[model samples]
Structure formats: structure tokens, C-alpha cells
Target: MTETLDTTVAFRATMGRLASGVSVITTRTGSTPIGMTASAVSALSLDPLQLIVCVGNHLFTRTAIAEHGRFAVNILGEDGEDLARTFAAPVPDRFAGVAVDDSHGVPVLQDAIATVVCQVSQALPGGDHTIFVGDARHFTHKSASRPLVYFAGEFGVMS
Candidate 1:
């Protein structure tokens, strides 16, 4: 037990040093939208245009993505720290007062630096998280924006 706890703590500390862009993964169940802040998102393939996002097992957004079969990754800019914290919090109705575009059937943040709509292609087990592999379907980006980054448990912009 001690070894497991030590490893977990060490793992988190080591991973924290590696900066990552922040994003909001969104999906819908009926007309209600669900979303969560995420940093464990990455491109998995280019040939098939795939992306991978790890969702915690305890999050309801994980189940929503599984059932909905689609999701949008809203890449946050430096101006999006508040949006990140809002979705990360336990607040009910994270979308309240937030502008969104649901044209692709998945809620996309209008203020995001970039947005990628994807169709879920595979779901794999990843320790305490579910690894969702998605096929890119639609995408939009703003070239001039700076990405919101997360490192050492704090949010910032790239130097």
C-alpha cells in the first residue's frame, strides 16, 4: 500500500512538470450539454485523423461521451482560465452564461482558440480513466491566439 501511494504521488509530481494545453471536452445527452476541463488530450494518429482524450472514471462526462458517440475538444486560449476553472468546478450548469455553438450537434465554446469535433472510434481502459480515441470530423482554429497551458498545478501561457 505504501509503495502504491508513493508511486502515485511521484507519478503526479513528475507529470506535473510537463506542461500541457488545457481544453474542455464537451458532449450532449438529449438537449443538455455536459463538459469537463481536460489536459490529457493528444493526437493519436494522422493517417486516420484520430485524437485521444483520457476521462476520469468518476466523471459523468465520460459516460456522456460513451453514450453520445461524439465530443468536441475546445482548445482554450490564454484568456480562458475562467472558463477552465468554471468547467473544472462542481458548479451546476457549467454552460450558463457561456456562449456556445452546437451546430455540429456537440457544444463548442465560441471563445475557444480552436475546436475539434470528433466521432468516438474506440474506448479503452486506462487505469482509473477511460481512454477515448476519436476520429476528427470537423475543426476550427484561430491562428493568432495563445494557448492556455497547465503545469505544476497552475494555469499559464507558454513562454
Candidate 2:
């Protein structure tokens, strides 16, 4: 048990050194929007425009995404630390006072550096997380904004 715990700690510490862009994955169940801060998003293919997002199995957003069959990845800007914390926390209303647009059938963060709307193509079990493979349908971005980054247990901007 001690060895397993030590390995888990070491693994987390090691991965924390790898800088990654932060994003908020958003989806809606009927009229209610659900979102969560995630750093495990990546492009999987370009031929058919596919990306992958990993959501923890325990998160409500994971089930929402699976049920909704669509989601948006809001790549946050350098000024998005507060927004990141809001979505990452267990707040009752994460969207309180936050600007959002759901015209595309999924919630999109209006202030995000980039927003990608995707239709879920596949879902694969990935250990403690669900790997959602999305087929990009629409996207928009702000050319002038720098992305929010996560590294070593902190939020930062690329220099």
C-alpha cells in the first residue's frame, strides 16, 4: 500500500513539471450547462478534425458530456486563472456572472482565447478518466490573446 501511494505521488509530481494549456470543457443537459476545468485536452487528428479530452470518471461533467454527445473546449486566456478556479471548484453555480453563448447547442465561453465546438465521436475508458474523442464542427479564436498555462501546481502565462 505504501509503495502504491508513493508511486502515485511521484507520478503526479513528475507530470506537474510538464507545462500544459488550460481549458474549460463545457456541455449542456437540456437548459443547464455543465463545465469543468481541464488540462488534459489535445489534438488527436487533422484529417477529420478530431481532439481528445479526458475527464475524471467521478465528475458530473463526464456523465453530462457522455449523455449530451456534444461539448466545447474553451482554451483559456492568460487572464483566465480566476475562471479556471471557478470551474475547478465545487461551487454551486460556476456560471454565475460568466458570459456564455450556447447557440451551437453547447456552452461556449465568450472570453476564451479559443473555442472549439465538437460532437462526441467516441468514448474510451482511460483508467480513472474517460477519454472523449470529439470531431470538431466549429471553432473560433482570438489572435491577440496569450493562453493560460498550468505547470507545477500553478497557473501561468507563456513568456
Candidate 3:
């Protein structure tokens, strides 16, 4: 009999080696702000200014995105590990005590390396996650700082 490999473990380990930029994907339901740490973001296109973020079905942000139809992608800087952890945690207010500013009426991390405000162009099912494709409406970036990176299931800076 052949021993079966644990595909889940193997897949995670393999994907963990793929370094990705860390970001906070935020969306709102009315006055309530919801966000989470995510590294599954991609620039899908430039001509149409398209971007994509994968959100797990279990996250509240997933429902917010579907209801509000808009989101902000805040690209974390090297010093944003604390913020990343805060967002990733099951906190009551992820934005509590966190400075934020509005972009196209959506809340974005204050002084983030980059922020993109987008409208939900489409949402597709990606296995257990939902792929939210956004049409970039507005964006801003400042400061020449290194980005926060996720690799090997840990946060690191590209140095």
C-alpha cells in the first residue's frame, strides 16, 4: 500500500516559501469598519486598473465587502507588524486607537506605504475563499520605505 502525502501540509509549506507583501484589506458595513491581515493580493490589470484580494468566507470583512461593495487595500510598511497582528487577531475594534483617513470615502490606514480604494467589480468563488476583484477608483502612496513581507508563515522585511 502506498502512503498518501498530507497535501494540506505540503501545500502550506510550499506556499509559505513564496514571499508576499502584507496588506490589510478593509471594508465597512455602515459606520462599522472591518479589516484583516492578508497577503493574497494581486495586481490583475493596469489598463482597467484591476486588483484582486482573496478573503476567506469566515471573515466578517467578506460580508462587509458584499454588502458595502467597496474596500481599501492598505499596503503595510516594514514597521507594520504590530498593525498586522492587530488586524489578524479577533479583536472587537481593529481600528480602535488606530489612525486612519478616508480615501474615496473608505477608511485607509493612516501613513500606510500605499492605499488603494476600489469598488467590487466581481466576486468569484476560489475554493473556500472568495476572490474579490476590484476596479481601482483611487489610490495614493508615499514614503520610500520597505514593505512588510510574509514568508514561511512569519512576517519579515526584505533585507
**Alpha-carbon TM-score of each model against the true structure:** 0.96, 0.97, 0.94
For model 1, how does the per-residue alpha-carbon lDDT over 1-159 read when each residue is reduced to its tens digit? 345888989999999999999999999998999999999999989999999999999999999999999999999999999999999999989999999998999999999999999999999999889999999999999989999999999999975
Which window of 10 residues has the lowest lDDT sum in candidate 2?
Answer: 1-10
Q: Model 1, residue 153: displacement in angstroms?
A: 0.5
Clash pairs of candidate 1? none
Q: Which candidate's TM-score is highest?
A: 2
TM-score of 3: 0.94
Q: Write the per-residue lDDT of candidate 3 for residues 1-159, one digit (tens) a residue.
A: 433578777878999999999999988889888889999999999999999999999878898998999999999999999999999998898898999886466789985799999999999998779999999998888768899999998999988
Model 1 RMSD in Å is 1.3
Candidate 2 lDDT over 1-159, as tens digits, reads 345888999999999999999999999988999999999999999999999999999999999999999999999999999999999999999999999998999989998999999999999999889999999999999989999999999999998
Report the lDDT of model 1 for residue 87. 97
Q: Which scores higher on TM-score, 2 or 3?
A: 2
RMSD of each: 1.3, 1.4, 2.7
Scanning candidate 3 in windows of ten residues, the lowest lDDT window is: 1-10
